[model samples]
Target: MKIPAANRSFFLFLFPLFFVFHGFVRNARFIRVTDCLVLTGAYFLAALILYLLFYALLRNSINAALVASFVMAFYLFFGFIHDPLRKHSIFLHRYSILLPVFLGLTVLLTLYLRKKAPFTRLSLYLNLLFLLSILYDGATLTWQSLQSRSPRFSTVAVFSEGQPACDTCAKPDIYLLVFDEYTGSRTLRDVYHYDNHGLDSFLEAQGFHIQGKSRSNYWFTSFSMASMLNMSYLNGISHPQALTSDDYTNVWEPLRKSEVVNSLIAKGYDIVNLSPFDLPGHPSTVSQPFIATNTKLITYHTLADYLERDFGYVLQRFIPRASKLGNVYKTNETVISRTIQASSLHPARPRFIYMHVALPHSPFLFDSSLHRRSPEATNVDFRLKDYLDYLPYTNLQAKQLITAIKGNSGGKAVILFMSDHGVRAWHDVSDFSYFFNNQNAVYFPDRGYSCLYDSISNVNQFRVVFNKLFRSNLPLLRDSTIFLQDSE
Candidate 1:
């Protein structure tokens, strides 16, 4: 097509600019300046290919080229329409009809617009609209970037006692295994009506002292973990209302850069972090082969959850293969696999393994027998049955981890098994009780120091451990629990 050089340049830049804008918005958390440059370059290449094809198709008709570019720009910028198409499953089952109708409408609109306007007039209007949209998107991105750099609300600092000493001849390897949203046997039996005796018996027989009436210090993962790891209640140092806010910077800071981890490292222990969470100080033992081992992907798993809620069903109809990626039921089998590796016998430094297993938590992937549940069986609002259904899989994996670590450690390791919180189904008032009822168990080496009580809260866990093992005088903080509703 014999398009003006100005018009051709405008069309070429617009689509790639739109791509760059949207890509940056979607990936702002992980995107670096370098990444932005690469994304712009990639989209430019794509835009060039499309421009060549459209030029060839127009066959020297300047009007056709102008209209085609406008139509293409419309479709590219309005791709959010694809989201609505995916969100509704009923339309997708009959996508045979719906898809064709949509395509026909688009084609008809393009044809009408082409014949209605001269090339120069249409190009001028499109260029103006494109410039406005690009400016708006670019401005918004810049504002957000600046806002994210603003100083976050600071909270209390994490306090620690003197350096923990290894009183024993050899410092035992430490394992802190956390299963997300897992409740104790009491809650399992009383509320869920599921007897978790088998796993309890297995641990008991293996010499673990189970804290039967154990509770968590805080109501949620971030708060509970921060308290437990730092060995004190968050309210002690941080503002009393800090937990009421979702700003977990105080919690995350101590977790990623924890004195507990540092103390162990100073004492010749290698920190092995196997959680999917991006705790940058410690290297991950698991291989994240799916997502490139980058800072953005791991830290932003919540985005996947957001997509599934908004577009999962619709996506399933079009790209059935991509359903797994959208499936909230999917487990991090790689975590289990790598944990097994971490627990294996190797001639290395004494290790402290921190593993966060996010299963038996949501989408209720597995049944009582560790088999993946059918999609039909899965529910958005998982019930007690759904929670019970996942027990077998997690139980099996938990047993395997315990056995592997014990076998590898040669009777010289301390294993602490706990949950960040209990069953979080907020439907029933009584469900709140289980929220505080956490699963807690510890296996100290050679039937070592036993100050374990039946009613210990997570905050006092490491305090007791350091007191007994390291001969430190860390006092037990009084146990407490708070029922969290929201960030309000």
Candidate 2:
């Protein structure tokens, strides 16, 4: 069927709108729907401006719409085209070679459209195609949202109301400080050849028990943390195969509504989320570092993102704020300050503060002197030496943070300091077992450290805590590590 000329120009706007919606739908699990609002409005405005400019030049609405569609497609899909070509051929990756090719194609398309009659049939096909694509994504997003609202698992079911609790037990302020990518002391000594005994001794002197052979139950943060907080292995809550799936809603749902957190809340404990990501009811105190909350698929894969990944050190010299490395520095600084403030709060109810500090992870931003390293010095190579130098800075910060917490809480707080996983960036290493070796330490005011063992994985950390502190007889799962295919 042939469409009327009056509606042919509408496809130009529909294509751009579809582009934005498609990207949002792909990343909806990580980001919120409202996060894409500004970007959608911007794409529509750009499409309108391009259509008006092309119509003024071509003197035909259908011809102008076709040209605008071609431009929008090229602009939005540049990164997708560049990434694969760059991996295979150097010449094909260069903007000097690719940009001119796109320009020439656009020019030839314009000349062809000028000679031919207005293609109303092509416009109708595109309009139907884009409309169908948009509806599909919208439906998928709505179904996922409804599923999330009614999750398969509930907090009430996880922590039964009949579970035992100690009414007379002293509920000291509990703190779980998770340091991302801090390898175990053994890994530091054998792999990196750096002795982390100083930090261990400091923790021991301050009434902390350091687990020498600690390992994470899972390699990825979401899986490890979800298992840790829920006090169950991945197979218990959801399918073990879901660990490899791209969609993390199953893992993240259990994490957000953790049984440990819910049980604490039920016992009159305040929850403080000072982490990089949100928890059940509380949002993150600081903004997430590299990826902003409003990030979408197209925004993350733009030409600028490729440049930042490849040539960020050089660009940082010119525009320091533009670098994501700089953002990591700012985020770590804010997390430290805010954590200290949260510790000092003397609330009547005992508090459970979850402070996840992303340090010694990536974007090695600090030196041994506690000064921000120069942009040129920021190592993307993930070298062992770079990691060793950065570890001392983290150690210093950890010491200061622990001391402040002890002082503010009057030596009456239970602190659990551990890492999500070990150093995962060492690509050349052969033996991958060290990837699970993470740092684990705990400080209990009552000096009850007998229940803790040497090789306790993250999945059993909270179980021991609950049994010791609240008399909650949660059975300790076997300490074992399930290595996933991908670390991230």
The prediction achieving the highest TM-score against the true structure is 2
How accurate locally, in lDDT, is each candidate? 0.65, 0.78
- Across residues 186-218, which tens digit of lDDT does each residue of candidate 2 receive? 888887678899999999999999898899988
Count of backbone clashes, every candidate in sequence: 1, 0
Tens-place lDDT digits, model 1, residues 424-488: 76774354667788889899887754688998998788878877766667667778776555433
Off by over 4 Å in 2: 1-7, 23-30, 52-59, 86-100, 107-117, 140-157, 236-245, 290-299, 369-371, 425-428
TM-score versus the correct structure, for each prediction: 0.70, 0.87
**Model 1 poorest 10 in a row by lDDT:** 289-298
Q: For model 2, state the Cα shift of residue 202 in Å.
A: 2.0
Q: List the residue pairs that clash in candidate 2.
A: none
